[model samples]
Target: MPSLPSAASAADMNQVEYLGLCDRTAVEWETLRNYEMFSLSPDGSFPMMKASRSKAVRLADREVMMVGGGRCFRVSLSNHPTQNKLQS
Candidate 1:
């Protein structure tokens, strides 16, 4: 499996390939490696946001609604989260 790309290296990847890499990595870590054992919140009751100046609200369906950089998006609290449709 290809290693996760660094910020500089990731610039060479197109959006689709980058997102694909992220999906594969998540599957490897969550399903194959069982890395969730190291998670601070396994149930995802408290989701973390790394985005600067972002606001997040936990939804009823175990998804987080984030607003940052003039964009709003939802992220799933699941092992194999699906990618959101990209807006042009």
Candidate 2:
């Protein structure tokens, strides 16, 4: 296993592990601002985010690698996200 000495490095490593799961669920929504949210896993294995027409649905679901509904829990976002104020 890889070693992470610094606190930041340790946190980053954990995020990678959380992302390297089997599957995740999400939805599309509209937002004024744009940002990226990677999984909080140690392995950090996820598809790179890019510019797109639709917004991403921020979700905290279970990793496909494990089973059962109560196995996992919700984690915080990569960073603090600002709410998009849309004009009608």
Candidate 3:
């Protein structure tokens, strides 16, 4: 079995992958909102912007695994007030 990445490494990888995805999709990273949906591949080679509605309950139950820069991350969507975090 593979070991999970440390929190710092995971965050770093997430930032890098997020930036790459933004560039590929012509999205401004600084302008991304919490509600935006991105369809990321397991290898993070092809990232597509997904259309999301305003249904918080439905969105909260979805989880995605994104891999990039030789790192893998489990991203969970949540509608809980405390779970919302601004990633910078």
Candidate 4:
């Protein structure tokens, strides 16, 4: 797929097939509270999953593989208004 605009935020990167640390931008990933691990859907209609500081990988679709805190987890994207965070 073609590259998104220069100001592509995490929400705009839902269709991205790959994700890395370099893909994060302050305007997109950094929250007012903290730069926590999170994921959102393309249409901005889904709830945001705010996990801990973890190594994460986004699948080709709307799913994320997160590994941190001595465990690994998988999350499926959906349209809900809730914050699913892992408790430390």
TM-score per candidate, in order? Answer: 0.17, 0.19, 0.19, 0.21
- Give the number of the best model, judged by lDDT: 4
Model 4 superposed RMSD (Cα): 16.2
User: For candidate 3, lDDT tens digit of each residue in 1-88?
Assistant: 9998676765566542122222233333233344554333343343332233222112334444332222222233444433224532
* lDDT (tens digit, per residue) of candidate 1 on 1-88: 9999666686776773212111211222222221121112433333333322343333233444444333111224344435463433
lDDT of 4: 0.36
TM-score of 4: 0.21
Q: Count the backbone clashes (under 3 Å) in each candidate.
A: 0, 16, 0, 0
lDDT, residue 28, model 3: 33
Best prediction by TM-score: 4
Worst ten-residue run, lDDT, model 1?
17-26
TM-score: model 2 vs. ground truth: 0.19
- lDDT (10s digit) by residue, model 4, range 19-54: 223112223332312223333533232323443344
Task: Give per-residue lDDT, candidate 3, residue 50.
Answer: 28
Global lDDT scores for all candidate models: 0.31, 0.31, 0.34, 0.36
Q: Sort all candidates by TM-score, best to worst.
A: 4, 2, 3, 1
C-alpha lDDT of residue 45 in model 3: 42
